[model samples]
Target chain A: MSGRSHDIPEEVQVLAGEYVLGALDEAEMLAVRRRAAADPELAAAIAAWERRLAPLADAVPPVAPPDELWARIAAAVAPVPQEAAERPPLHAPAEPLVPWARPVRPPPRRIWPWQLATAASLALAAGLAAFALLPRPVPPVEMAALTPPDAAAPGFLVTARPDGSVVLTAAAPAPVPAGRDMELWVLPKGASAPASLGVLPASGMRMVLPTPPAPGTQIMVSLEPKGGSPTGKPTGPVLYAGTFGALSP
Target chain B: MADARTADEPTALLRQVAAGDRVAFRRLYDLQAPRLYAVALRITRQGPLAADAVHDAFLQVWRNAGRFDAARGPAEAWLLGLVRYRALDIARRGGREVSADDLDLPEPADDGPDALEVLAGSRDAAALHACLRQLEAERRRLVLLAFVDGLSHSEVAERVGMPLGTVKSWIRRSLQSLRLCLEGAA
Candidate 1:
């Protein structure tokens, strides 16, 4: 269906709103889902609705869950095969059925953002060093860096860095439908609105925003239509969001 | 009863969970599970189903703990989102739907004007409770059905024995009114 120029249709907005409120029926919900996949405008509207009505979920009081529930779930989604195989045997009791009798111990510390960023930098430097020792071919000058959220693996990179300018280089390729683009978002601390950096390619291509965002700010990428976010702020699930720790001179 | 430590916030506990701290996850579960379970029970109505939903939700918490982004919303909202989605998914699967008769919640104590006065001890929570009291009986029922029972429009209509259209409009208007009432109280 054809959409109006420069504005989302009122009916679409209402539908999106209801969908966010969980008021729509199963059929209506499916229709919204299909449209959201194809239409960026509808997706943005639905995201806005999700944010507004999210607070209502907090109105209900909490209840404690049964003990066996967590264990059942843990058994289902355990990451490693060896871990999964070892789980039941580890938990199976030899004598008494009193599972709560065993003393509990804490798990290991998680990988912090700083640690992940440092690791990525080291890996990048190592790769560059390997390249430097091998070929005499001229290296590309301008580079753009795409860092994922702290502690997350670097999903993409930027190759063309010119003083303040940068280009997005996809580390791992992502699928993008025709006529759609990935818009970058710069979310500063204490700022509600995410600033649009520019549109990026699904694979890897070059597009530069006004300039690199302020240091220590979170850089995010969300899928948007050709021109970018109409609302001037992100209205999509953050695909890649990370901070800029240091820029190479 | 273990004295709940107020020093560590939910975010801190979540961070610990992200680091693979199972004990911290258990502590976090203890701190927040009661309210989340209450929500699930209210929505699912059947105790076992609610328990199942809560179980899945916390397991999601454990597995996807690393995905917790503090910038989007609070730890409680994130956790509650998981529960709300799970409860709705269960309701959609046609396990057991909450009926209005199933939701015969005790009427707020009618201490007349002194109700608000007595609630002053916990002003914020009291304000919310008072505003909830201000809603018309039917509207309050609708809110409870939507928030607790996780009933969609048609389900609410079925429970209340009202026309689906009427139930939908009532819920929308009631939510708007409640938002205004709570804002005014604040």
Candidate 2:
């Protein structure tokens, strides 16, 4: 361990202490979070504050949570099933190809006026094919609903289009700190790296996010200390999560 | 059944909770809930929210039991931190923002003697509580904020209307003083 000056600066220690106590404003809070992610020393300092202050819980009397709360939390935390396993099997007609069939050959012909017209039509078709191969914009589609894990309830509705733009409208209000921000994450099944959609507005009403991943991706909300995750992945507890399944064509 | 032995040491119970022992967690809860609840209730001054704070705090302890480091602090401090953080989080969310004027310090209860009395029969707890009592008023408040209200130094500053710098210095000096006091007692 480094000396108080070198290992953990006294100023940063104080900042970490304040952070653990919930004292910094939104901006200072964000700076501390970023520092904590990069600096293990600062994190340890904050953790120390957590330990020192943890004993004060002795002041309050304990009350059991409602029986339904645990069940609700468990349901929310449950993992969502992926598509390959859940999709219905498709039954389609199959065509058989023959190996011994004779190949048809066209007769050698002169270039006539009608043949010239036919050549022009073929050239036009090739040009159209080239045009089709070029990149084009995909239109956005409205995201209908986000289904919670275990099919317990629809927690939020997302409206998004092909342009990579999305809007998250919470069907129910979520508890969020006044100075802190809620962050949205897309947790693909079995994936450890949760893609951050963006910061969620605390109002629990409506907020727009950058382009989301394709449908059937699991969406999660975490109570970030402030700004957003200093690390790209979630470092806080996930508050709510649901999967956005594909809508019928 | 023969005379049941009181599981005197908290560390043993904490070890069980760490191992996913629900029965142990319940016992731990039964052991610590009163004090934890009192802490939350004092800060928030709302019964239902205080209950929520306790629930959230215990749930966190259940989930993060493996993260406990005995070298950093005792089991009681760690659990208190959980409840305090949860209560502070609730406070920041504006669940119930009671001003200092609104604080109603309950009279010391006379319910068949207090926790200190029961623990005084034991050596370690008695020594620890005695050491804690030796801290100055400001330092004691800081400890309470950290353990009971779950207020970070910044939150403490906001609640007390002091500058962040002053609050930070107070907490550090207070901790240092408490450490010295505990060492002397030990």
Candidate 3:
């Protein structure tokens, strides 16, 4: 065997360290990122250096970010609920008014059709809030009643219209505590992540969907930070849920 | 470094996050974001930029949680790495407002245990501490300034009042030495 082995050149090793150290300039940084994606040798070197220097983070003191920062992050990732698209922007920017609520996860069980009338009161109660935002009512093409798994009474009602909008009405001024916002989510059957429907207002609000939800899609309500679930899904306990079946004309 | 349990919990969370579990994603974020924010703050030295960096990093994590490979490193390190790179990108693009004159080395003694002392005590990081201690003090500080403070090569030179070439060579030599030492210790 030859005395010399094919070791990574010293130049590449140092370059990896420089990249990991955050010592590379903009052009070099971008170049490294691009190259690392396709270059296994370079990628391995970068990963190794990252592992080596990661402990240095312990040396930097942890600083708590301002509360609004999380809200912005959540809002960024949360899907633009179709309802939000049609509604005019709030006159003043809505400052998160409440502290983050403790998140409640949804039970594994599914929603049943028997609970429809049980939640009709919630839809009726939300009509006042809905009327204020939506000038006139278009007949709903599809509807789902959101009810907490633990309770027999439905807490909210959702309806889809031919115009591809979804409306949510609350049973009463949903005992939403201060500092919390109730956000809506939809988990299509067989999917892993739920998409944000948008934050529900005090009574009821109308939203336009980018496309009508498919049958067997589950609509849910989750307690979240003021803006929404920062991670783009349900971060809080799922308060209620109902399923949409085959579209009815 | 965190204990095995503490470290493993985030790894498990990342796995769940990869599987599209939002609860795990939020739990992971809650556990990691503060530290990540601080790391970004040190690099950018600007609140808004740091927040932006943290924000972008979390979004990437949400989108690419599947990329995390537990066999390679701890989840915390992987997370810190993501924010650090993002902060550096933002800091560079935004143009660092803090000049070299105002740059302060980490305080020797502050509210808690000294950072270096804490580093020394960490089981996973002890070898790194030992390896770092082997370097000359100036070289050691250069590595920390570059890695923790997110200084670029030119910026490190400006901060230490060294020429750009000398700073580059010193950093390269220091890294090589540290790498050799770490590998030997490992």
Candidate 4:
């Protein structure tokens, strides 16, 4: 910050700090995120900032979560039945969650540091790809289907153009109550607020987003009052949502 | 050896988690969930949303634990970062039905140690806190508002009754000063 560490530009340092601090607006946040994927220096600066400021989190007092919370997490992370047969039982924890007090024992031999390094590097590579950080040319047109959780068929198809305009087409007339209107919202990656893209007409509509959302950004529709959310944010239930790049035929 | 192992507890657990060790995953959950929940709660300002953030973050930990690079940062920070990002996302989305139970929850305490004092309390953070203390009180508070409370630049400016441009400039300068001071101390 003061003296550039590692010759990182002052702009990059400030941007990293702002990104870590969650200060950048949606557009700026997305730009920083995109830059960090391919920019090792920028990523390192961000990591360094995260390390320096992380300890300050100790000041936030701990609060006990609901008793049911653990069970919910355990169930959510539990392997599918087929996968469960191949691994240890997730539910019954005979061993303590924290083995810190137990007498020292030889380390588990299954995973070695080198092996972990390999996995970490592979994961990092995969992460870069998943974030669409590759330097490949941008696809002119991208699309995703927004589907309800219970329904297999996509309720809406979102066609996003390079110009940051999105066309939302509903498969069926959207089921809106007499006085309610459905609104479209884009939750850009790393952005603090979901920017409203305006209300959706029953059949289909096209609108321009301030910027095209990144691949992992969430697109959602919430049922609002007769008009879109009175406050700039979504007020009603998120009736449908999907990741931007996760297209379905 | 025991002390060293204890220090590496979270890291070891994370490695096990990467290998599909559910027991270690649960243990790690037991160890870190409360602290993470507190972080989520602070940022989202809603209990249900906080719970959702922690829940989602832990699932990411379970699935992507292999991606954790020890050399990049501490295991705890890696974990906290996940929840913080999730909480921020939920907060930004804005309106969801507030759960009836959340209505009875106590509001977060506004008066606590300022950023410097909070950092000063921890051994790891003490030096960083000292660096932070070197900044003017107002600039330091701006840093705290942005980081801890998860307020955006405009929100911080509004709270402090300053122009947005002035607030942004002050925060940048303050961060640079902290970084410089910490580097000198090191």
Best candidate, TM-score-wise?
4
Model 1 interface DockQ: 0.13
Query: What tens-digit string does per-residue lDDT give for candidate 4 at B5-95?
Result: 7669999999999998877887898889999998887777655567778877988998999999998889999998899877776665552
Docking class of 4: acceptable
Off by over 4 Å in 4: A1-4, A81-249, B1-6, B95-115
Relative to the unseen true structure, what is the Cα RMSD of model 2? 24.0
Tens-digit per-residue lDDT, A14-65, candidate 3? 8899999989999999999899899877787887888888887888777886
In terms of lDDT, the poorest run of 10 residues in model 3 chain B is B104-113
Alpha carbon lDDT at A210, candidate 2: 15
Which residues of candidate 1, in runs, are more than 4 Å off? A1-22, A28-63, A77-79, A82-249, B1-8, B97-135, B178-186
How well does model 3 score by local distance difference test?
0.69
Full-model lDDT for every candidate: 0.54, 0.52, 0.69, 0.69
Candidate 1 lDDT tens digits, A4-75: 212666556666656655666667667888989999888766654444444444454344554433433333
Supply candidate 1's per-residue lDDT for A102: 12
Predicted complex 4: DockQ: 0.29
Tens-digit lDDT string for candidate 4 (A221-246): 88888867777677898888888767
Candidate 2 residues B57-103, lDDT tens each? 77677677887777766777677667655666556555454323333
TM-score winner between candidates 1 and 2: 1
Deviation of model 2 at A192, angstroms: 48
- TM-scores, each model vs. reference: 0.46, 0.44, 0.59, 0.61
Error of 4 at B59 (Å): 1.4
